[model samples]
Target: MTLLVGVDIGNSTTEACLAECGPDGPRYLGGALTSTSGVKGTADNVPGVVKVVQEALSAAGRDQHELAAVLVNEATPVISGLAMETITETVITESTMIGHNPDTPAGAGLGTGTTVAFAELGACAPGERVICVAGAGVDFEDAAAGIAAARDRGVEVTGAVVQADDANLIVNRLPTPIPVVDEVTLVEKVPLGMPAAVEVAEPGRTVRTLSNSYGIATLFDLDPDQTRLVAPVARALVGNRSAVVVRTPSGDVADRRIPAGTLTLIGEHARLPVGVDAGAEEIMATLRRVTPLADATGEAGTHVGGMLATVRDAMAETLSDTGGEQDAAIQDVLAVDTFVPQRVTGALAGEFALENAVALAAMVRTSRAPMEALAGQLRSALDVDVHVGGVEADMAVLGALTTPGTRRPLAVLDLGGGSTDAALATGDGEVHSVHLAGAGDLVTKLIDSELGLDNRDVAEDIKKNPLAKAESFFHVRMEDGTARFFDEPLPAEAFARVVVLGEGGMRPVPTRHPLEKVRRVRRSAKHKVFVVNALRALERVAPGGNLREIGFVVVLGGSALDFEIPDMIAEAVAAAGVVCGTGNVRGSEGPRNAVATGLVDEHAGRTR
Candidate 1:
């Protein structure tokens, strides 16, 4: 019997699978997965590679020396970048809107009054309701004290908008509780003496009055035409716990459409020009018009230009680091149009309006120098014969063939973190593959932007784990239409709201979005990346871009292991009258460690 280890370094994860081979071929032993230390094919990945190998060895109850050989995948590293352009611009000359999610807003209910500076609040006439403005220069203590003194003098300070991260701090010290919205970055720009509305909801609730256009219209006594102009302001404040909107007569907010800019796709025959505003379908249609892209450039001084430049520079630097002085030119770029719900500048209600953006990942084909360097490092550390495996797609197809009921003339979609790779194998054993960007990381960015989570880690958790809403103390309703009962009561934060299934435990999501809404966003993001990429990849390998021409499709790599993704993709692929399912590596390991398992199987003959 021969014991061997296979390692596959992905953009986000590092995996190792162990197998024992004899005359009967190969038998599955064990596998382990961990976060990749850094970019794949780089020396920084060695530590994570060693960790996963050691874990698989421990699981198999085998000594490191007992392993005959170690094979690491020849990873095609990709560099991903994100760029945002605000599609909707509101230019309210005098009225400033503040709409953002501050973790700790204070008190509840709406307060409408004239805007007044904190220092001048005492000088205001009695009985006139005033909304105090506190700039960043004012501490929470002084702001609270000033408001209290003004109130004692019979001046009604109905509400307050502050610049510091002290909304809860000032509210707790107030003589009588009033709504306090804090963390306004442009507090100094807030127009004093203008009519304003401040609304703060109770804990775990979102402000309603400010989120509705009709509500703002009634409060401000605006005409229909004027109310229509304020609709964007209301939309931006939809999910915030607290908000403040000031009315400036000259303030006319217009939703100015920013040109996302044009992209120049250089092809062998001709160059195609597409605008970012044209959407993904149009951008991709333009790409299809040009079979093989030589290089892509964005118009200078535009968002797309900045975005493309960023990706190229990053890939060039990474390649230079690995290959030493070699000019790293980006061979190809994949662009996906996505949106980001970004907070508006000088917004009074902390509002976040949806902004148009592009997500891109650039690929630079590299030589075997990096792989050789990694092999040298591993040999010095593990004291084993390290070999760089065959092409990643070829090994994956070979491993995918181990799945029950799968055979030649099939296609495999290696949906990984950085890229979606598809390979087609003819009945006689010839394979053709294409690697493109926009995969798991792109989905994570979409989730983060749409939900306005502002935290990539949380967005990733939301993407990978099943979502549920805590309905009662004893049970939580899961996204799969099932309820999980707990023997002990859940934490208060997890009650009556959506929560993400985190490694530590059930963690509550702060947004006011319902469970179904969050689930919809998550699924939509997956569709945008995986489903779209699957068809795009297969079309390149099939004749006339007809998916029906392909017989079967087996999904490999880490993403195929997602709970709902495989079934979703399978259903979609079946529409083309083609059979599709997640690969079961070696008939035991399901949809994971394909490249790693394939490495061992492909190396078996050499060992013999």
Candidate 2:
């Protein structure tokens, strides 16, 4: 048997796990969790990690040499990617050119040739034949719903489709075969029928077909020429010089004209689409294959910001000169997320792929295809033999485990400052992780925002636990369900006063409720949002069909230490029918040490 150590270096805490791996697989020996020494993802990482490692070894009564090897992931000396997109104008003509995505703000439909109305589309004048237009009267969601309503009810709907940027996605929901033009400024000009079609430049040519009797017949079931002046409307529709024409409604299309109406293009909006998602699978894929976030932001971002072809050449050079043999493995593996930030803004004729950029940037685990390209580029940059597996923060400890959980799968959620990372590990080596934007720091931000307290440190305290006023005396109730009444009441001046006396310069609060109720509400409110979101994230990762299926879960990192946060979540999870407990990294500390312990576990491999 060989002894291995896993060191998990985190932003606020560090943990180490010791394990022995042999013929029977890996077995856990002892572990140590401690406060981290310094900021993570910096040159200071090694020292903090070393401290955790020593603690773990001391617990096991062993030395570092007893360890067989060491392994590290994107944690500790954290490495990643970043990219910025700024455009002068993201909106352009043709929102429905298969790229527009008008979400929610507008209803779904392909409407054309109607007079403009001052009122918004949702509230149209009865039979005014006027187009509804309202500023701030609707949102992208509103538009999408309206369009959808029109299409589902088979109404003649048309207009310049507006979306919250993802025009193509909105376009996808519209009635097929109906021309739902997106991105236009002049929606009113689109003529109604032949009487409206007269503006067409070419009355005799196909331009006239736009507002012609045939056009009306195509868009609506209107009898041929109810009004004789329709010649002009048709002329305006299919204008000479390569004009796009809405096909006339077919008599058999819907067994009748589909609430026939003209199709018009308006609003300058871009489309953004989120491709197939596989949660946070791409995080590992990225560290294994894409360029580091530092590299991208430091210098690589500049390179990719320019001509994409330049990025292509740079990728080739980096790969050929440095990637070596791991190229194939890195290139072949796929991550699970694909995101498109704000779609096409111009008349982009051909495909403008982000594959090469994503490969080079390799920051977050976004999507499958983009991640694959990132993998290829990553292989070319690194000389080390890298393998993509396990959670970034919790895996190190798990790797040292010798006995499988009596349960088939377990969830480990590591809450950090910048991001909240939760992973569900299947005994079979398959892991699903969810990396959300909010975590410890975000909690502070929320507290600050909620309390109207601009103080970061105060917000931090509120986030870690709950707060209550000292009331009549200088005493206050703690969130752990305890109260401390002071001997003397606080001076009114101390309300917002920063008293440097407390461990964290805490200030007194004035509340309408008793100290106990205030503490309870604060703690309860935080948990309601954070715990619920975390559980939902975990549920999405677990292969188990329901919350009850998850037999066990471990909570780690700074946020977990919230005097009542862990218990709050425990109760919440239990309510969902699962057995859950706060993490005991090495039998002492709770949520603070998973990262450091994980580091040791990662290097030591299957400790059990």
Candidate 3:
């Protein structure tokens, strides 16, 4: 019997399958997986490949010297890079709005008056309507006393903006309740003597008057042009429980569309140019117009240009030693429409506005020289015969066919970390495949950026696990609205907080967003990446770009292991009359080890 090992080097991991070939066929012995040492399809992967192979051989109780050959898939180095360009920005020339959700504000009504400093409240003439501005140095008790004394003199204290967290204290001491907005970090920046309006909502409610443009217009008696400019301020104030809109002589808010630059799609048939500001849908539509993309370029000295250059440069640096004649070229691009929370240009408090952005994920493809170079390195390291195996997609399809209830004319979706690959196999032994950018990593990034988590690890955990709100020490409300009871008490930090139910136990989400909001963002990010890429890949592989032509689709790779990704894809493809589900390779390995197993099966066929 001859012992052989097949290795599949993926973007994020390296997998190996060990098998023995006998008179009848090859019997699978064992398999092993480890993180890829370096970027896929490069010589840096030698160390990881060696480690995985040794593990597989050791698990199968075979010595390295007994191995006949080590076969590796024909890996086309695919590197995916992401960039986000903010198309719309909200810029306030003057400090016109303080729209932040302070945990505790006072009163529940609208108050409008001329802004007056706390020290000047005593000098205000009787019946003069004014809003009190308390500095941090003033105590809440003293400020309340001063306001009460001014009111006793007939000075109308319509509202108050406090530098400290004393809104509740001040309002409780006042005989007549008035709206009070507190926690104004940059109180000094508030324009004095200007007309301002403060509105506070009751508990468990959001501010209404200040959140509407018409409401602000009526308060300030703004003209048509002035009202148009304040629309962005109103938008920024939405969902806040308390807000303060100060109208200065030169206060201006502008929602401007930035010139993010253009992208040139180089295809086999035509070259199309698309503006980054045109949004994601337009860019993707232009990409579809030019199928079989050869390369993509961006305008010089522009955001899109810098983004594309960065992706190209990264790939070139990794493939510098591969001795390839051509430089790295962008083979595919995936554009996603998303919102990024950007700090308002001019605001008293650190308020953020959700700005429209287009996130692009580009896939760089290098020649086979890199894989050949890697093969030589592997041969030297292992001192065993190393052969570059068949096309990766074909091998994956072959491995997927081993799954029960699978047969000819089957399609496979290899959803990995960096790219989404699709392969269609027919009875005549012909395989059609396409590789596209954007997969699990992109989804994680989207979740990270959209939710403003700024942490990939936390976003990944949220992507992989279900979320829950800790209702009590012993019970938690799950994302699906079901209650889960724990025998032991939960962590104190998780009480009344949104937590992720991962294998390592409950991890509290650091964001102040509620459980439902986080869950919505997570699911939306998944749907945008996996479900969209699945359909895009299938259409390119299916005959005449018709998904209906494909009968069965077997999902493979790391992303297939996600709890909700497979179901989302299945639901999406069902509309086209396609049966889709996660693949259980060999009826034992679930959605994994397909490419490695296929490499072994192909070798066994050739030897026979």
Candidate 4:
């Protein structure tokens, strides 16, 4: 009998299942688990996968050389980024009270100017210039001190747009009768030395109001009608705080340019994306991709106002070098609005593709075709038999699950690490299958983000086993909504960390409360959402509208074995009026061995 090893390398971990083909079918043997040896969506996968197989071999008291065939399941990473766009359709002429976070503030408005430190200009500088000095390189305590120093140097500290958070404390030190605006986080949006009026008005008002718009006209002598001309300019301020209408001593007014998102951008790649040199239309195009200038105070990478210092420096350099052209370019760039929480994974795909047994691997950009990249990666990595047995990933997994099939018209949902893949099998063969973004990694990411725990291990703990906070000494809360009562108060320190699970219900949850709670909730929620969504997606692709007509669904993959995911999915399927449950691909041993057994079974069933 020849030995067959089936290896599945998922995003978070790797697994190997060994089997021996005999007259009676395939006999399962050893298995092992390890952290993913390399990148999920690349060729460098063999070594890591091979290592797990070797462990399986040794555990079965066998040797690698005895292995006749090795079947490796395909692994591809699912990368996702959040995209948000706040398109302001309706513009009210008078309601200038638009507010957002430091990472999100945008829109037009007006204020007066005055020379004051962040600590003194609270209420008085409402209609004046405000300077902010509470960022990383600046001192919060010494803002007043710096103002004094600037006065000594004969530099006028004219105005300030204070960070929204620091407004209450910092606006107390203004020497002049300045009006301090509290909510504007990008206080630096207010340009220094340009002591003039700030006005954010609208189109709807200029015609209707023969009278006034308090916020903008309060500081400047602009009639409501004139303010309408500047409505477009005001609307553009949705992202930045610096740009507003200015009335010079000559009574002539123009929209002045202010700097925002000038954060220093630090990227892994040495070269700028798309183009190298400036002044080219390509750069202009790149600027347009930046966003409509909603909030002028943030940067364009990592997150809102990312690399603030860098964006500022670049904007300054671009302006100084090309002045008007640069300003025009900034507006073009501002047209490309950015959503919140910028997501980026470093440039590891290239190195990741250089793996053993990897005949092909493709690295595609966000704007490119993903399947082409998959095809490319496939050809580069698995040079041998890239198309043999219709070597597609999800389809093959279904084939593996159905080799022992009592029926056709069956669907298999393989919930793997990087992405959730589903395949429907018909009597003729594998018919429909699809790959969707988001999976274990996404769950882990949510855990990491929500828990604020930089520790992935802790996050993983939260995902696998939920943690419950012991509300008091005798009572503890579990992830599933059940509460356990205890005799006394648990340790205060462990109040918020992940807790441990035990026989009596909740053993001391390993993680603290809150974090533990967040992780557990996120993990459970993702499982429910993904499983239900996957089923719904599959049903849409079903031959007919009726899911009840479909016979069987085999849930395979690591996630299928999660504590409650399988049951939850079963209930969902039952609700859909169909029978569903975890795959008994390997009977008592769990969902293991299905792929390898099917691989060998295909040979035996055909021969028999």
Candidate 5:
């Protein structure tokens, strides 16, 4: 009996399978998995490969000296990098608006008047409509008293903007209620003596008047051009509970489309350039027009250009380290339309506007020379006969076939960290495969960008785990609206917060978004990356670009073990009348170690 170990080096992980190849056949013994040390298909992965092989051998109760050879999958190094370019920007020329949602604002309704400081209210003429602006140094009681005194003198105090968080206290003391927005961090920046409008809505409601362009036009009696200029200001205040729009002589707001540059798609037949400002749908459509894409490049001196260059340079560095050619080409690109909350410029109070952005994920394809170098390094380090195995997709399909009740005419979807690969196998022994960019890592980035989480680890946790709302100390409401009870009281910080049900424990999401909103963003991001790529990949590999031609799809890889990814892909592909589910290699390992097991199986067959 000859004992051998097969290792599969993936973008995110390394896995090994051990088996005994005798005269009769191969007997599967054990498997092991660990995080890949460095980039897959590079010399840096030698330590990870050696560790996993030793682990697999130990699990099988075999000595390293007893192993005959170590086979590794022909890993194609795929490096994926993503960049977000904002197409739409909201710019306030001269501090035109204070559109931010404070936790608490007082009263409801619109108040328009001339802006004046609280100390100057006493000097106002009777019937002179003015909005009181209270600085942080001013006491809330004194401010309220001053407003009441000014009102008694018929100095109409139509509205109030306070620097401190005392809007509620001031409004409660007023005999006549008026809109009051508080917590204006940059209250000193409010243009005094200018016409301003303050609108505060009731609890659980959004401001209406200031959020409407026509309403702002009517309040300031602006001309058509001025009204057009103020449209972006209204858009920035759409979802705020309270807002203040101050009109200065030179104040203006603009919604501008930034020049994000263009991408050049180099296909087998033609090279076409698509503008990034045209949005993701248009770019993707243009990309499809150039079928069999050979490579892609970006226009010089632009955001997209810088992004693509960064990706290429990083890949080139990795290849150069492995003694391969330094020139790297982008093999695939995935563009997604998303919204990022960017801070509005020239704002009195810090305000964020949802700007239109295009997120591009570029994948670089390298030659097999890197993997060959890695295999050589592994052989010398482990002192074992290490040989590069078959193509990853073919080996994955072979291992997937070991699933119970699976047979010929099968397909496999390998959803890895960096890319999504699809392979279709026919009964006649013909196999077709395609690799596409954008998978788990891209999805995590999308979630982080879209939700403005800015923390990849948190976004990844949200992606891998379900969410819940800590409704009470003893109970929590899950993402599916089911209540889960606990014997112990939950942490105080988790109360009334959206938390991720991670394996470690309930980790509270740091954002202020509600449970449902977070859930929607997470699911939408996954659908955009995984579901879209799944369909795109399947169509590419399916006969005649028709999914119905494929008999069955077996999902394999680390992402396949996700709590929801498999189901999402299955539901997405089911419309084509296909059978799709996660694979169980050898009816034991679930959605993992497929390539490694396939290598051993193929090796055993060759020896036989």
Candidate 6:
């Protein structure tokens, strides 16, 4: 019995497939997968590759000496990350605009009054209509009773701002109804003795008065110049259910802008300059026009320019160290249109506004020096004949062919962590492939920015799993609006939240967004990354650059295992009459162990 091991080094995982090869043919034995130790194609990946091989050998109940040969895939290395530079920002010069949502705000009308702290309400002389500010130390019950007492003493309490989540609690106890804005973490900082406007709309409605610039001007009797300056403040608060605007001294705060800088696309005799503010569509369109990109650069003394230069320099340095003859050059860049939620600088309440921005990932065409070095290292360590196999894309296509019901004139979408790769295998043994930046990691970055999770792991969890809302101790509402009951009560932390259903069970999501909102964001992110990339990739590899020419597609890689991604892409490309589904590599390995199995298959032919 001759045993052969095939190892595949992927961007996110390293897999090993063990098989028994004889005169009859090769039979699949077992497989094991582990997280890749480092960047693919690098020597740093040797340890992880070895561990997976050992695991496969153990699973198959075989010893090291029983292996006849070792085969490894020629892995392509890709570097990916998220970068942002806001070209133009809308800034509120004065401390104004509270655009956040509290679970339950109170009242229905807008109220304008002088700002006064809760403690000072008792000392009011008379008839001073005020918006009471309740800070951390003030109890909601006490604040409500104090407002009623002050109203009885002829001091009209028109509205209230609170630092805690007790807006409904306080409003239910009030004698005369008043607009209330709660969950203002900086309530103590509200400018006292200043004119302020508070607006709380009815349930299922957003504030109209505070969210409009003209309405704000009408209430404050502002001059034309002042109204124009406050326009951004109102625009920032457009979608809030409740809002507060307090007038502070002018010039207290100024908007900040990071020069987005110019992108210099160096092509054959054509150098075009594009701005980061031009948006992703324009940038990609410019790239499409200037094909065969020689090199791209950013303007000097700008955020994007510096970032591009740094990446290029790092790649060049790394390549030089690997004994490469040519300097590393950036071949392409992928840009995604996204927004980052930024907090207002001087606002008394915690307020955030979405800033239009773009995130980018660059791709570099590399040599085989790294993979060659890694193969040499593996050969010495494993004490066997180990060779770097065929081209990465060709191996992927061959492995994809092992899937049942797939044949020639086929397309394969390999959606890995760092890159999305596509290949087409023709009937004449011809293959074509293309690699693009921005894959799973890019989706995580979008979720992190849009939701303000500030944690990549948490964002990744939201991206990879389904969501459910813990409506009660024993009941949870699923994303599909169906309720489920649990025999035991849920943990306190999971109650009243949209939780992610991860491998560890129900974990609470740390955002105030409802289940539907978070679900929409998650699916939208996937659509933007996976579904869009699937079509884009298919177009590139299809005959005559037309998707309709491609007959079938097999998705492979870690992302292919995602519960919804495969189905989503399949449904999306169904219009093109393409049969798309996750690959069952070797008719048994599922979506994984494809490249590994292909490595052995390629080796068996050589032996014959």
- The number of clashing residue pairs in each candidate reads 17, 103, 0, 113, 0, 0
The alpha-carbon RMSD values of the candidates against the true structure, listed in the order shown, are 5.8, 19.3, 1.7, 15.7, 1.5, 3.0
For 183-220, candidate 2 gives per-residue lDDT tens digits of: 33333333223111111121233234343446555544
Alpha carbon lDDT of each predicted model: 0.82, 0.42, 0.90, 0.45, 0.89, 0.82
Per-model TM values vs. the true structure: 0.78, 0.43, 0.96, 0.48, 0.97, 0.91
Off by more than 4 A, model 4: 40-43, 73-407, 446-461, 472-475, 480-492, 496-532, 606-608
Q: Candidates 3 and 4: which is better by lDDT? A: 3
**Where in model 5 is the C-alpha error above 4 Å?**
none
What tens-digit string does per-residue lDDT give for candidate 6 at 216-261? 8898888998887777777777888899888776533344566788
lDDT of 5 by residue, 464-572 (tens): 9999999999899998899999999999999999999898888989988888888899898889889999998998989899999888899998899999999999999
Question: Cα RMSD for candidate 3?
Answer: 1.7
Q: Model 4: which ten-residue window has the lowest total lDDT?
A: 351-360
Superposed Cα deviation of residue 222, candidate 6 (Å): 2.2
3-27 per-residue lDDT for model 4 (tens digits): 7665555555666667787878767
Using lDDT, give the best candidate's number: 3
Residue-level lDDT tens digits of model 1 in 1-608 = 98889998887788888989888777879899999987678898899989999999999999998988899987764454444454445544555678777778787889899999888887898788999999878989999999988888888888999988898899899978999988877788899999999999988888999999999999999999999988877876787788888888877666667766898888889899998777767877888887687778889997778877777776676666666765444555566666676655545545656776666666655555488888999988889999986888888888898889998888999888877889998898888988877778778888888888888888888989999889999899899889999999999988898998778788888787888889999999898888888887998887667898789899987789787778788888888999899888878888888888889888885666
Pairs of residues at least 3 apart in sequence or in different chains that clash in candidate 5? none
The local lDDT score (0 to 100) that residue 323 gets in candidate 1 is 61
For candidate 3, give the lDDT of residue 81: 76
Q: Which stretches of candidate 6 lie over 4 Å from their true place?
A: 87-90, 116-129, 134-157, 162-175, 249-258, 309-326, 482-484
**TM-score (C-alpha) between model 1 and the true structure:** 0.78
